[model samples]
Target: MDGGNNGGRINVAIDGPAGAGKSTVARRVAEQLGYIYIDTGAMYRAVALAANRAGVLPSDADRLAELVKTVDITLEPGADGQIVRLGGENITTDIRSREVTLKVSEIASHEAVRLRLVEMQRKLAEAKGVVMDGRDIGTHVLPGAEVKVFLVASVQVRALRRYQELSEGELVPLEQLEQEIADRDRSDESREFSPLVRAKDAEVLDSTELTIDQVVAHILDLCRTKTAEAK
Candidate 1:
């Protein structure tokens, strides 16, 4: 078993590939623990959104860094959940648009962008009581976190789930969603700095056949156990 029982407050780091229910599980775990849930992925998505607005191509590293510096990124919670504000303007809905998704992987693959965002993520997690979720949280963002959970699921399952969500509003076919999921995994895994990988000490949880509540409960149990030990 993972050792080190102390009174230090716990920080949960959840990492995984695309469509792996990382966001949902992390949010619930944070809510149950009364901790702030910071979505590091949203920061990259915001950068992508800003790049699109500035007309900076993905390869334009200098322009991308400049654009990131000019923006003030903040996380605010609402009744629904967290909202991402860039430059004091809430672009929460715009950041999750299809266009942002298309460009996010490219921007995220940039070393400059990831480094800048990683610093921000670290600052946000400086306080112990936080549950941060992202592709690299377990490995790079919060290596010293008390509990590191790497959530994974089969590509087919993830693709189908994403397709179902998209289909609720738009008419996206299964094949298209599968292709997008595959492409995103490729980008996330192949990125140079802090590519997605489970930390050696991370607890691997495969959600391939589990319901959302089941996964949330699984993570919550771990969180509670860790918190009890740390007390």
Candidate 2:
């Protein structure tokens, strides 16, 4: 499907399960296209980190929703990568910690939380020319996005990739990482609100046998083709 141009800003939505390299590929694609890279997952992770710091359980939906309103989450483009700020503090690395990774899905599953965050996400992409990646970006956050790509890889491959990415500081067992990824997949797919599902119009790309550059190139090609068709 061709993504229609909106005020010359092309909106790209990429969705996938955990460890599918959505964030990395999305960043590179955005850089290549010179578009804003919005990591919706990281936004949720920021919230989870705050909730954890505040002693709010993931099951406390009401409190979590209130907490979301109180905190300010911002994403900035940095020389190295996107920097995530929560309430004016830099928690870019904190949100990626194991604790946040374990509870982000639960916090994100809250209906109220999703509503609030989705509103913010839509606002950020209102002008388009953005590449957003998340479990529901194509399915929910940006249903009208001109270019949508659903990236996927085998669980084992994704686990290995994640392990390698995190192996520099911590020594997590490969088997444990695999199970965590599987668990996250189940949680994200089984959630009652905005469960992870591929958008019908999104092109499914399997990255199990593909390199990062290859995936980025494929998506860039899609963007070029769709943009040209739109023009």
Candidate 1 lDDT over 1-231, as tens digits, reads: 233442355889999988898888888888887888998888888899889998999889889988877767999887888899988899888887888888898888888888888998998877677899999998998998889999999989998987766735667778887899898998888888889999998999999999989988988888888877765
Which candidate gets the maximum TM-score versus the true structure? 2
lDDT of 2 by residue, 66-168 (tens): 9988779999999889999987898888998877888998899999889889999999998789999999999999999989999999999999988888846
Alpha carbon lDDT of each predicted model: 0.86, 0.92
Instruction: Point out where model 2 deviates above 4 Å.
Output: 1-7, 167-169
For candidate 2, report its TM-score.
0.95
Once model 2 is optimally superposed onto the true structure by TM-score, how far is the C-alpha of residue 193 displaced, in angstroms? 0.6
Runs off by more than 4 Å, candidate 1: 1-8, 167-169
